[model samples]
Target: MLTDVQLRRLTPREKPYKLSDTGGLFIFVQSSGSRLWRMKYRFGGKEKLLSFGTYPEVTLAAAREARDQARVELRAGRDPSLTRRQRQAEAKRVDKQLQHVGEEWMKAQSARWTPRHAEDVRTSLERLAWPDLGHIDLDEITAPMVLETIKKIEARRAKETARRVRQRLSAIFLFGMAHGLGRHDPASVIKGALAPLIKGRQPALIDLEELKHLFHQVELIPAGGIEEPLIVSSFD
Candidate 1:
């Protein structure tokens, strides 16, 4: 067993060396005077190493417990080193969501879209959707969050615009999923969730009398002024 008194007496040298403890754990003393704890083990007939932690900060007892835990994980056919790396990679992948994937999807679609339309799509997201959803993790976004955005647009009497925004968000989510940025499209669950659009009433003359009355009013414009000709010709 490695004693605390012996550990405290360990001094740096011209080169790095390790003082081994039982069960593949060691205290690696570096020339720079940093004593870090390390563990060496084998999994699947391959040798792998794990770091328990540094000395002083991580006591002897703590290092031993960590080594025991690693052994348990190994007994269950799990490589602690590989598992740690996989978890780290997954965390990194999950962080690249929403804005990151969205920008990438837009770049890919730029070739297929007109410049004006591409800009319109970008503007819609930046001005409307991004404020709420841009920084969110792709998988973490929910239908309620997206619907709230649409409802905000609807509250402004922009029902058609809200529908278009929802469609864009859905497309972005799908794009993210295809590229592995998200697991599922949250917006897919809600369709027709926004308020229905009310079409505007068109103006029309009710009868011949109304039509003739409009024509009569037009004919009353004073003749020969530049504005009169322009105003009269506008009705044509």
Candidate 2:
């Protein structure tokens, strides 16, 4: 058994050495004068070392308890090192939410985009995509769910808005996948399914009578408050 006094009294030599305790737990004293707690064990016909912690910060009793817990895990046919890693990974998984990850992706890409474009990206996602997806986890989203979300925008006669939203969704999913936050890009496969962007549809005033009526209405407007320039906008 390693005592607190013995641990404190341990001095570094020219080379690193180990002071073994019960159940394969030991203190590794390095030449740089750092004492690290470690355990030696075998799992699946291979030897592996597990670290408890450094001396003083992790006391002798704490080290023994950790070693005992690791032994229990090992007896259950589990690898203690891998179990620790999994717990660590779970604790670090704070960006599982789609909106959170999307915002993060936008911020990361913002420097490459114009300020107006970045704001537009943020607005489009928040307005058209987030109500359906913001609360959901990245991995939980499906292609059908994405389609449904954009379909609402298309139903509003906003096909152009829907196209932009879909493009942004694909970019967000791609960003999530590239960063290991999601399994796949659900939006990438459905680009062709959206309502097409319509341009230059036939004017509502298709005949001479309707054109004259529209001109009459325009004449009734009070002159020159930016309305004339707006009304006379080039077709191009």
Candidate 3:
């Protein structure tokens, strides 16, 4: 049981010395006066050491909380260190086909969006989502992963950017699915996870700009073509 006062008073010796705490947690005081927190544990017949972090910066209570979390993971039959490493390594592998799917989706969709807006959407995904998720398969990228990426923009207090980026993500997923490149829209699962944008700002589901674009798209359809069947069926 090391108190804060005792922790502050701990002096560096000729070599590293560990001040023990409960549950195999301890602080290693190095000869250079640096204090680091570590936990000793065993799993699958192998002894392991987990590094908590530096003392004071991580804080005693925070280190204990992290240790308890690791214990919970251990109880659940999971290796916390391995899980962390997997998450950290997720971005290193690139899936070129899925990135190509994104580019194809953009090219097909660019006709529906203004040139500037298309660039904006592409840039948002490239800046925030692509680094973490562009490498993952469309169906393999989970909702939690999309939520995590969107939350980064939210964290920066860019409410509008976050909102638009989330929309773009969902549209991309839907586009991929329509083209048989994806099975689901993970972004749609995290719709309300972000902080809500200003209420009643646009104030219409079919706003003027969207309405114009809708009409423009409709006009682009060839007369007496496949669209005539849909419009005729609409009356029936």
Estimate candidate 3's alpha-carbon lDDT, on a 0 to 1 scale. Answer: 0.74
For model 1 the TM-score comes to 0.47
Q: Compared with the true structure, what per-residue lDDT tens digits does model 3 show for residues 64-135?
A: 998898898899998878876786676433322356677877888777676755665576678777898887
- lDDT per residue (tens digit) for residues 78-99 in model 1: 9998778898997776556677
Which candidate gets the maximum TM-score versus the true structure?
Answer: 2
Question: lDDT score of model 1?
Answer: 0.77
Q: Tens-digit lDDT track for model 2 on 50-81?
A: 99889989999999999999999999999999
Report clash pairs, candidate 3.
Answer: none
Order candidates by lDDT, high to low: 2, 1, 3
Scored against the true structure, residue 19 in model 2 reaches a CA lDDT of 93
TM-score of each: 0.47, 0.53, 0.44
Which runs of model 2 end up more than 4 angstroms from their true locations? 1-11, 14-92, 202-236
Go through the candidates in order and give the C-alpha RMSD of each one to the true structure: 15.6, 10.6, 16.4
Please tell me which model should have the higher TM-score, number 1 or number 2.
Answer: 2
Q: All models: lDDT?
A: 0.77, 0.79, 0.74
Give the range of the ten consecutive residues with the poorest summed lDDT in model 1: 227-236
Look at candidate 2 and give me any clashing residue pairs: none
